[model samples]
Target: MRAWLFSGLLVLLVGCATPAPDSLYQQLGGQTGITRIVEDMLLRAAADARIKQHFVEVDIVRVRDKLVEQLCELSGGPCIYSGDSMEESHTGLHISRSDFNALVELLQAAMDQQGVSVRAQNQLLAHLAPMRGEIIER
Candidate 1:
């Protein structure tokens, strides 16, 4: 009876143990996956009438590099962002809520295209959502 009780308790303890946390970077398929998502997003954004104007004056390659860095760092990958602060970058744009929503939809669609899990997409979105105040000028 004592041995059986000990065995049961051991099983219970093991079952109740917390699992290790999964990294968002790994969930996003590491750097390669991140790059694919960014590329898709940029293409979608460029074609989007609501947001395409914003890309008109910018160097698309530079923009892509910065975005890749930003998303990599945001998702716990090995990259550093070399871009201006969110507020600094958008200070003169006078961006509207609709523009913001348009970009977000494009990002979501890009993530979906890359086969990113809904949970991983939500995780990235939650991390970025706080930047709205800084990015939206109007």
Candidate 2:
């Protein structure tokens, strides 16, 4: 009885202690701000030959707009995410962890270019951190 009671209390405490979702758009300035970051990030990603292969079959212009829209929605800005789910979008792409990491580095570089603060960066990253699991299939 005591052990069960202790477990219930622990669960309650954990639930109460959980923080709210970290919305990136609010942190890195706002709506227009995230668009600049996405633009820069895509540019950086395009410049790298290794990662560029992934975009060979893509429409770069559409990709950029979709990315901006997705980011805008993700950061709590007034926008909708029109892109497909991670599994659906990446299907047959064989994206590896290294490729994802490279893109992430480029993204961080772009965020830095826009002068996002450290705390905001971390919050943004944390918001995006879960996608890493869903995105890297290879």
Give per-model TM-scores.
Answer: 0.82, 0.77
The runs of at least 3 residues in candidate 1 whose Cα sits more than 4 Å from the true structure, single-residue gaps closed, are 1-21
TM-score of 2: 0.77
The ten-residue window of minimal lDDT in model 1 covers 14-23
Tell me the tens digit of each residue's lDDT in model 1 across 75-95: 877677899999988899878
In Å, residue 73's CA in model 1 sits off its true spot by 0.6
lDDT of 2 by residue, 1-138 (tens): 999999999998876444234545666667677878888888777789879889878987888888888777766666788888877878788899899989889988988899988787777777778888778886
Q: Model 1: what TM-score?
A: 0.82
Best by lDDT: 1
Number of the top TM-score candidate: 1
Shift in Å, residue 108, candidate 1: 0.4
